[model samples]
Each structure stands twice: as structure tokens, then as C-alpha cells.
Target: MSLYMLPLAIGPWQIALIVVIVLLLFGGKKIPELMRGLGSGIKEFKDASKEEDKDEKAKKE
Candidate 1:
């Protein structure tokens, strides 16, 4: 199989455009709520992984 390369260059304008689009789609009021939910989800995932690691260590010992 052959590998395809992606464009590695992204400038400030591209980032600004993406931010603007997100704001437009989510609107000003909803972005904070979405971010809060996203943060909690990520935290929950990390906590679960840590718990799993502790369980594995306990089993091995």
C-alpha cells in the first residue's frame, strides 16, 4: 500500500477562518456550554483510564 501525504502548513488566517466558522455554527452563547461538556467528557475518560491502570497493577501484585 502507498501512503499519501497531507499538507503540513497551516497559517494564522486558516486558524482564524476555522474559529469564525465554529462561532457562526455554534453561536456565541452555546460555545461555552459545548466546551464545558467536552471538558467533562475528557476528564471522565482520563479518570477511567487511571482506575483501569490501578486495577491492573493490583491484580499483578
Candidate 2:
């Protein structure tokens, strides 16, 4: 298998267009709620990982 990679082609204009569409669809208030949910989801994932590490350490002891 070749170690060289193919480029996945997404550019700045496409990303900006997507962002504009999302903003138009969701509006400002909904965007904040969506962002808050995203933040909490990330936080929950981090907390879960920390808990799993503690469990592994306990089991090793």
C-alpha cells in the first residue's frame, strides 16, 4: 500500500457558503443553542474519557 495520500478537496469558499446557509436556516438564537449543545457534547465526551481512564487505573491496581 502506498503511504502517499489523496487530497480531500474542500476549499474556503465552499466552507463559507455552508456557514452562510446554516446561519440562514438556523438564525442567530438557534445558532447559539446549537453551539451550546455542541460544547456540552464535547465536554461530556471529555468527562467520559477521564472516567474511563480512572476505571482502567483502578483495575490495574
Q: Over the stretch 1-61, how does candidate 1's per-residue lDDT look in tens digits?
A: 2234335466899999989999999999999999999999999999999999999999999
Model 1: weakest 10-residue lDDT segment is 1-10
lDDT of each: 0.91, 0.90
Provide the global lDDT of candidate 2 against the true structure: 0.90
Please, what are the lDDT tens digits per residue for candidate 2 over residues 1-61? 3345434466899899989999999997799899999999999999999999999999999
Model 1, runs deviating above 4 Å: 1-9
What does the lDDT come to for candidate 1?
A: 0.91
Measured by TM-score, the strongest candidate is 1
TM-score (C-alpha, index-matched) for candidate 1: 0.81
